[model samples]
Target chain A: MSQQETVLFDAQGPKARRRTMIGTVIGALFLLALAVVVVLRLAGQNQFSMELWGPLLNPGNENFELVWGVIGEGIVNTIKAALVAMTLSVVIGTLIAVARLSLGRYARIPLIGFVEVFRGLPVVVLVYLSVRALPDVGIDLRGWPGGQVFWGLIIGLTAYNMVIFAEVVRAGVASLPRGQREAALATGLTNGQAMRLILLPQAFRVMLPAIISQLVVVLKDTSLVVFVANFDELLSQGESIIRNLGNPIQTFTVIALLYIAINYTLGRLAQWVQARQARGSTAKATGGDDLVPVRDGA
Target chain B: MSPVIENLDLYVDGFLTSLSIIVVAMIGSLLLGTLIAAFRVSPVPPLRAFGTFWVSTFRNTPLSVVLFFCAFGLPELGINRTFYFFGVLGLILYTSAFVCEAIRSGINSVSAGQAEAARSIGLNFSQSLRFVVLPQALRTVVPPLGSVIIAMFKNSAVVGAFGVGGDLWSTGQTLTSARGYETLPIFIGVAIGFLLITLPAGAVLQVIERKVAIAR
Candidate 1:
């Protein structure tokens, strides 16, 4: 209950110590009361009833197979959408970044406009526009099984994320020491060749953590397909489950947990990669005299 | 283009709706986020744990799912409310987590020496943080905080599709699907509505980023 006193306070006197103890008890009690009220509220609504939660959480329940199979399909569809979106965004984004990095000023201007427009608009608008609007302009974006729904979701994700990815990779390349580019160019390589061989490979590696974190965003965004195109991803599937089971809270809670489970793992991987990079960039310990080469002795 | 021009009044109504959602959610999230951020940094252990729980839960969960609960699940709990109320609630609940993180990082960015100096002058921890550290931290936080708010502006579009109608997404959807209007121009008009808000906000943030950027 007391502050850390973190180089920002003197040693506590007796009165201060007593006050800390009192505050601790009061804080604990307050939280307990809040928890109790929440539980009581849920219970009052029959939210604690086993019929609502058992099929989702308990494998022994008779409907367990039915409920989970539906959710499993949702999970598969969600992964399919997010995976396609991520791959397309990275590949197209890298290409756009390369084009901008190598092209003339006039050529880059239109590409800049493309990035700005896509980045500025909302993804739902993008999906809706791609499906409903673009057919008039000779673009029928229907190839998948669910056609407009799936493609709308993917195209929207790609349009939004590819621009962001382009920016990320460009930033990654810009972060490289100028000497790396100068060194590549001084060796007589063409600008395109230099970018492909020297700059992009390194930029992808340097930006791996940022890219993974972005994938988490993509994964979460897949659920938006429910609202935009009704693609039967995790969210829409959850809605159907709610319709049948009459347990909106419990069903959606399970769906949310599934999302958090996957995205949290990806989020951790991003942190791990970032930490590894931080460690890699720091100077390592030098070897002792005996371990050093005689010619370049310590 | 003509369709967009013909439906200018509908566009304006949608634009106003979007603006109100943004304004309400923006203020609601900032207030809630600040309180949660305080909980996070406070010395009380339970409060800190509660704060951490709020941040991680919302951070990992999809906004759609949160809105699902607000829109559908809340009725199960008998907390009936208007869709706009629930939509704004979902936005605040989700966005405040990001806001809290931004604030915590801002607090961390305040150099420790400032607090130490404040204490050396006979101030307590609370006084030092409020008077000496927070002002500096708030300045450093403006840019990232701006980005979070921009992201929220983008996310509120999701609300309209979730039955919070009369906003731009619904406006665009209704014109194309029900009215059989040309999809390209009507949706483009809707896009312009959003761009009108976010693009200028981005420029203003850039200006603020320059104005308050500290050397240290």
Candidate 2:
């Protein structure tokens, strides 16, 4: 059985092994050719020239200062928008999730509709509509600094992301065995108390990793504010830099790298949280057995 | 004709353009994503690393950043094209990462026993994967793929910001500027149009998912 499992094939046979090796070589060659073509094209356009790249590299250069200043402000604005939206979404999402989970069909129906519609609609459309419609409907936020566009973006992001978070939270709560809430009730806790004290805490733990990853998604999506809204998030800042500097490649490259860095860090943190949770569960399982052995041996 | 009715042709044309872009980008991403997923699960170390690198780099970067690079950077590199071309290209490249991930998870869901059985019959890796693994994997993956496609459809809106004409987004912008004060009605029309496309697609996928759900 071990041998059968170990060899997924009949030791690949010599002929098959040779065929696999040939296939690998061909695949490598194809990739190399594609890379070479791209490189040559870029080189032909003088895209590799130091002149196009020097300002980005030299820290003290005026161009470097200008680009970084705008990008830095863009990053801050992006973070601000993302944080405000994320906070609002989480609060609203939790409320909706709980209402859907605990309330009657009459109450749940509207919340469900809210989630489905927002989830179905494209976020850009929502953002565009918010930015345009809010002012028209007499909610003139233009009086405040960056108020109209900022609030418009935040509202749109919140509406969309809140629905997603609602689903995540609901799924988290649903995954718990029915016994948990029932047991909490049996312990003299009210329904609200059971949910608030027992079910939600555990559900929140289960959903934390997903929530963090969604936050990263929200951060990436803040770039959408650049369109229809007069927001200078990183992507728009990169565009402005390109317009001024005539190096679209370098400017957008920096923006992409900045986005990747922030998002990658958050992604890694989520993974770490997931890993820790897995480890904790396993340790608990073994600890139960280990306690028995110690008690018996002693 | 009412304003919305008068602009019906523009909306229809925009819808068709969006649909075409969606069709092209969806197909491109699916094919590229399957290839990347294959690389990810391949026995070759370097291939797996490359696949990992590709998904990480593309997935973390914003779609707009990718679009900006493709639209502006490609032109600077002497690869000038219509905005539609670069827009669809950017959509495909960015979304393929997500598709790769969804499919990779689907591949993981396929039982090891199934692969073992295929291998025991002297089938090679590609052959077994193509004939046995992927069919089952794709059935489980329909739901996630639906979400990815929907996401790509939504993201197609971003391309319009770069002046790619004849999409719902651009049409909305045109109407908004044309009427100037009818922003509310024009955007409501656009949102409804998107909802019509997406809601049906989602319903159909959910039906398919339920029908094909493998009983464990």
Candidate 3:
């Protein structure tokens, strides 16, 4: 805003400065008053009492470690699902992208259909389908070491995100000059070999920031697994702790903060990389900015 | 087939709920988002900070969490409301951030000369923005705005899942989990329910994009 001042309003004179000063104070007071009202309301409900908050966060509380231990397990399960899904989505999405690009028209058409359908639906529906529908087909995930919920979550996340990543990869490749593909083909390389040796590497570099940021979306989407057949991810664990300790507000606040902390860090990492890549091409060319809506479940 | 037919009324009711959700939240977010975008670009430092804080907090938090907070946290503060009200509020709060960023970036993309020319012509900031810059910026904004709104449409699914009961995902889940209906057919119905909302929306947005596209 400092640098872009010319667009909105010019520098303020003394009277105008006084007006803005009063505006700022009023704004601050308004926000502060809202906070006070919330605090007062919570206080009336005895929400600030130590008994409500102790078991989960207070170190001296005997149940603190026990509660956190369960949450720690939930964190592990969430990370495990996120990591496995992220790895699979990236690898399979790249292969599918290459295949979609290099394949004949007949093959590409259905691939487009598959991508479109999976991309369009909410991921929880897919997760629910894998959990329930697959079992009827004798593809039971129960015997898997991670349990049905974990596998269900992974499969759904992978299906939705792989298509998104495929488009991202394709967009990256398309952003390059046409000569890169032609030059590789001119050197007597097969199409697959040319894409493998030439195009994909450059595309990945150009797509690094978007790919990293998509991981944040992947991590956030893991929250959807909270309802996937009692998976005990971060959210459900928060629910259980609340049931035991009788504090829905504090427990969910901690859980929300945990998600924000991890996601905010990853979001920052993507921005740092984007900043480094700022000079190369516009972020639009990547088509996978942090704001891109390929995110599953929210 | 039997299960879907049996629950046909529930499907209609739930989907209708979702449709209303899209309409209500779309308008809510757009109006709120425009205000925040204006706040972000304004010369006031406090307003800019407030805008930044709001965007970062919502954008970083997961939608499920936001909805969860609404479902649970608001009640704790004695802010009682219907599940439907809370769900819509959460959607508007979470989505307005994305809309703000899209508009802000659109505002930024408008060439500096336009604002300068507006000022020279004696139009003030809001006047220039309303008359000249925003109209141009909105043209560039439509495509991304479309994506954001579609994303919001899809996210209404979370509203149903998070205890705001009357939407397609929950309707399907109740049929399958409680009533012991067939999962495959119910899931298919739910997917179609979502597609019924999203596909037409996507087509409409594409049409709007073509109509409003600027050469620059």
Candidate 4:
């Protein structure tokens, strides 16, 4: 009985079991108290009143129409910015990752510096700088699709996500058994052909989950554009709605839920990809599971 | 002093503000994260369920949403506070989820035999975890924990956008607006400031990780 599978803790004796019951009761009570306090505080502030939440529920309200319209636009813009940035980052990241792996010191050293600098710097700073600096450099993107803010936000997202994707690609390539690349070269394939034909395909297959997870990170990070670039993405749009409607609680809650829904779906997609990859390959690639999204500050 | 040199104080002040927020949030997240990790690995089902719920909820939601909720929404809920308080609280709430995952992974790395042995010797759940499992688990998790901390430091820049004054990013904004067209130098300065902190911290953590690493 004692040697039975006890992954967490051993089966408890009567006395230990009683102690656990008491502890659970106390913990439950504490949580209940905390919830009560929060509710009371919010109620005291009139946050629960119909006035605060009416606009969200009332379809005929002009404010409701405006808020929803802005949020819809914000969603489109967020997706647009994220897709453009993700595409640019993946392409640039692949190039840099390959260069870093194949090239000598002159090429690799500068690339390494670029990755490190951008990775360390906050995304918000990069976006802010791009918004201000790009125009000064005569690359005004104001005449483009979503205008200056859109391009600034995309550039910023690219700068940070590119470095991350580069790391992912490098890890993917490095994780492949050396024999895979060597066998291609031994078959009279050029170095480029060997890499393109044999190595990169396997690397991409192994790294797809991580790459998709990074796309989710990029999507969430589009919110940061609101801060520096004056972009009316989902969060900023929510902010504007709150300002006009004076229902910060309701507006922010909806925005948070929307973000969670999108990011949660993306997260689940990443997990599903990971599961499929595991089933497809007998030789498990290391380091792909560790590719959790790192922080992207708003 | 040139404008860049003359604006050293702004950068210094910003650095200090960022450092303070990072320090506070790091400690807060570590404590909260460890508690959540304990819940996650507890023998009880409800504790584990609560821990999983917490991790999924916070982990899936965007940090900006969390920050905005704390900074703006809380004030409307009669919890008015300084921007620093709300920002730090938001950061701690969000980053703690990642930290909890890191710690949980650390906890998982400890051999099952260790815990079973401790139970056989009459050590209870908390005691066994404290005396046997956690020490080994924490050592293995140092590198991942370092990355989480660095992420927290970078994420602190988000506070700057929400009228949270006295951070490096905010200072850069001030400098840029004041200097008008000279945005490049100010931003470059800001980037250097961030690297100065993150690079050294990463290097130090690597050294610590190497030192404490257990041979498999």
Tell me the TM-score of chain B in each candidate: 0.96, 0.91, 0.94, 0.91
Q: Candidate 4 docking category?
A: medium
Instruction: Report clash pairs, candidate 3.
Output: none
By lDDT, is 2 or 3 better?
A: 3
Please state what fraction of the native interface contacts candidate 3 reproduces: 0.55
Native interface contact recovery, model 2: 0.49
lDDT of 3 at B33: 90
- Residues B1-216 of candidate 4: C-alpha lDDT, one tens digit per residue: 265578898889999998998899999999999999878766555676688878887877778788878877677557888988998999999899889988877777777888888888999777987898878888978877888888888888886666778888888778777666278887788888889888888789889989999886
Best by lDDT: 3
lDDT, residue A120, model 4: 85
Candidate 2 residue pairs in clash (backbone atoms < 3 Å): none
- Order of all candidates by DockQ, from best down to worst? 3, 4, 1, 2
User: Which DockQ-derived CAPRI band holds candidate 2?
Assistant: acceptable
Tens-place lDDT digits, model 2, residues A94-162: 998988988897877877877888887777778877777888788887777667888899888898888
Give the lDDT of residue B141 in candidate 2. 74
TM-score on alpha carbons, each prediction = 0.91, 0.90, 0.93, 0.92
- Candidate order by TM-score, decreasing, is 3, 4, 1, 2
Candidate 1: which docking quality band? acceptable
Question: Tens-digit lDDT track for model 2 on B162-181?
Answer: 67888988888887786663
Candidate 4 chain B minimal-lDDT segment of 10 residues? B40-49
